[model samples]
Target: MKLITEKAELFFDLMWSLQFFINTELKILTKIKNRKEYAALPQKDKQVVREKIYEQPELIDKYIASNPDRLNDNHLSIIKQWKNFIKGDFYIERYLKNHAIFVGDNNVYGVLGLHDAFDHLFPSNYLPIYVKTILLPFQGRIVYDGLMQVYQVSFGGGIKRSLSETYMQAKQNNKIITTLEKTRVKIESKAFVEVEQENIWTNEIEQLKSLSKKLKGGDGQPAINSPVFSLVKASIALADKALFDPSDIDALTKELQKVERAVRKVENTLDRML
Candidate 1:
């Protein structure tokens, strides 16, 4: 969804005011004398200054050091946090009730829109929208710097499914980053624990899948056409489904029992062959 009205206004005030100060300090837009004048300029003109500001991110540090506007310590802290900003081309993958999914190079971010929700900005069919923008930490959440550059390239079904999978994986693993202040160690550690727990329960099914790969035979051998591999493959599929939705404990238990029986039959077959 969108940021709160007052918070969104504060974000604009701080962000634009800082950009205006950057323009004045660097003399990029010499004609713009004050904040009011800078605000009056078309978005295209402001975009030019925004690009230049990010080009030399050191301007952010300089602004923090100078504190030209005599902004409060809280405001300066918010500006200082800009050093941790993430600037990149991201896929605006999907929109959820809480935040929009921004899939970056190696991470997924749950980003809040400033004045409007991402769904309002880009139609559902247009997604996953490819865009270049900077993600900033604002009031303990992640928000993109007000400017965004969207690419017009269309995606085929394959690419769309891939993006959807990426979003689902991020959500399943709790890997969607919601704040810039979060440490990777913390996020990864939690994800690791959850994955490990899930893997423990499905370890036997996974081993069966691996063993089926080894049992695969080339050419027209009997092993190539064995029904055992089919059984293992189906078990693996059921295991995967159970992994994603393990709500019905009794159903999962019955599925695991069937898989265990299959595992025993495979083990007996291998014993006799050996």
Candidate 2:
């Protein structure tokens, strides 16, 4: 019955809403990848996560306002709950572990490496310039893309049919010229996965800010340490080291002990979060 657990649960609930949208996009993509059709999806893949970050309070309110006939009282109640939950302190990565979910480490890898999951089956090493530029954000620190890179070649011809050139990057990462725009095509390869990572990271950042707000009690007092924040920071760092620096196992092993100390420092608070 601790507020710590209550807060953590709220964070998880908000993240769950976003993660579900992400999973839905992945599922839909699995079935179809054609250009004309993908453009016509009811929900733009990135917008699903964007609404949670950008629209949030207003969007939820708008949904309730516009869909009076469909929403009813129960629907209104659910949206209220969601808003309140996010406004609280729940954290998805840490709290979910209490239930024996296989997250916080290797699981984080899969979620983080979603964008380049393609190169794993296709071995885009042939396009080093492309992959290097694209993978810059997440390359060494997170995900099993290096491991997946070896296996991309094994993907059957059918799986490799659609995006044989610049892959997913060329298809999605494009630019439209208009209104005095020069004839320049700076097609930056920003994939949907990149946006997803940013959303999750932003959510964690917001959680830290919320914890800071609460710990300071809105006064000028120094912010107290948030145990949930500590756990998340340490967990994310450890995940980065493990996946990115596999060769330096000894170094990571030593660092993990330090991370464990951090977790222990906030263990009691984390227990409450859980």
Candidate 3:
């Protein structure tokens, strides 16, 4: 096991303690029914509230309290599904593995979207479903042709879940498109910067070439001592100073793994953007 300095671990501890802050600050967006709607659905058809929904007992409740105006049918379906996910009312294990059951092998979108025509290329589509990818308590709507909403509606409860309009949610699709473009630009920039850093450091440490001018004692001679002599001395000192303990092979390996994971995320995001 590689040891981390106590100071270095402080941030990890701080972040861990505040892990739930995001969920607390941002209201969970979900649907709930009113007494009238509850009374309207025939008891035979309306699924009864079970011990499960009462379990987390709080996830759905919190979500509902945040979004009270969503009595519409589309809202109810997603709410039920969300409840099912939290309560494991349907597929608990599958959820742990897949997030959403109907989405057995899907993508999980915490605050992202596949809100596009090409979303079909996404594996398992995305979580929150392509249906409710947007529809947050504060946020307005999903984009694209509203095609995904129609597709989501066609699945179970028909047109009730479909939204008619697009581009209503601050035009987030536009933001995502812009972000993707920026990410691509960033990658290109990194490529050039990386090459430049390598070259600069190489010049800083490169060894001096052998004296081009032969020195003859008290005779005609080219300069033996020159600018390269200074560079060679600096390079030797730099190489020594930069050397650090390499005993923690495992630690170094882990750091490399982290870099690889970060790169992978960037690559995946770029792929999605593309």
Candidate 4:
């Protein structure tokens, strides 16, 4: 069994904690949005309504305080704005009209988007379902995209690439473009993981070994022509890895056995469509 080092364990713990915080914040925002008072508030006054409805301002404060190094100028500005909104420091309509430029922006969403991408690539469930090798690069791409948004106000750029847009472009070109393409784009844009610039994509995948180390199980490979083939291959690769874990080997084996059955069922259904 490969023993998880203390540093690796700590890093994983931090990743989990960050994911939890992002989910909690998203829930709070959703709750505020669903409130009747939120709907009744004037368009400009909604920020105030959100502030009044959100119960845990301290959580936001704590996050900012703890992650000073992670925050950029845009993050600091948003934090200040949030603090002001929470304190009810300005007249609602006037403040809204004056700060109309910042009305729809929420830095928290960028953070949440980053975490969501991480979860998509490396699900926290017992049976993980994505290839670390393939997913890590995509994960980096997602982080880059999220950070761009988080610092968008302070850092002016014409436009940024979207994962969905990139996927579509790949499909149109009849290519199964993966992480290599994103890396090339990052290099061309001169944004190839500069941590000093608050880019988290740097070194995120350095520890990951190649997928070849874990791809020795199934005969059922996804069709390269499929638009979502990359994702499907990733999932299969993950299942394969889980089935062969050195420790608790049977635990993942049974879980992925179930997944294999499900995949077979789906394939049979698709076969009928032919």
lDDT of 4 at 161: 23
TM-scores of all candidate predictions against the true structure = 0.69, 0.19, 0.17, 0.17
TM-score of 4: 0.17
Expressed as tens digits, the lDDT of each residue in 232-273 for candidate 4 is: 454554544543442465666666665666577667657766
- Judging by lDDT against the true structure, name the best candidate: 1
Model 3: per-residue lDDT, tens digit, 1-274? 1112442243222222121222233322113233333334342332223222334536455545555444455444334333323111111011122112221122211221222222233344232233321211101211111112223422333321321112122233221121112335476567755664554544434432223123123344323333333334434443423333234556556555555554555455556656
Q: Write the per-residue lDDT of candidate 1 for residues 1-274, one digit (tens) a residue.
A: 7799999999988888888988898788998888988887888888877876668888888888888888999999888777788999999988888999999886888999999888888977678889998999887789999889899898888988988898888888667788887564476678777776765757776676677677654478754245476566658767776766666778778777777776776667677777
Global local distance difference test of model 3: 0.31
Ranking by lDDT: 1, 2, 4, 3
Runs in model 3 deviating more than 4 A are: 1-221, 245-274
As for lDDT, the candidate ahead, 3 or 4, is 4
Q: For all candidates, what are the clash counts?
A: 0, 13, 0, 0
Worst 10 residues of 1 by lDDT: 222-231
Report model 1's TM-score to 2 decimal places. Answer: 0.69
lDDT of 1: 0.81
Model 1 Cα displacement at 100 (Å)?
0.6
Clashing pairs in 3: none
Candidate 2 stretches with Cα past 4 Å from truth are 1-49, 52-56, 85-274
RMSD of each: 10.1, 23.3, 21.3, 21.7
**Per-model C-alpha lDDT, please?**
0.81, 0.36, 0.31, 0.33
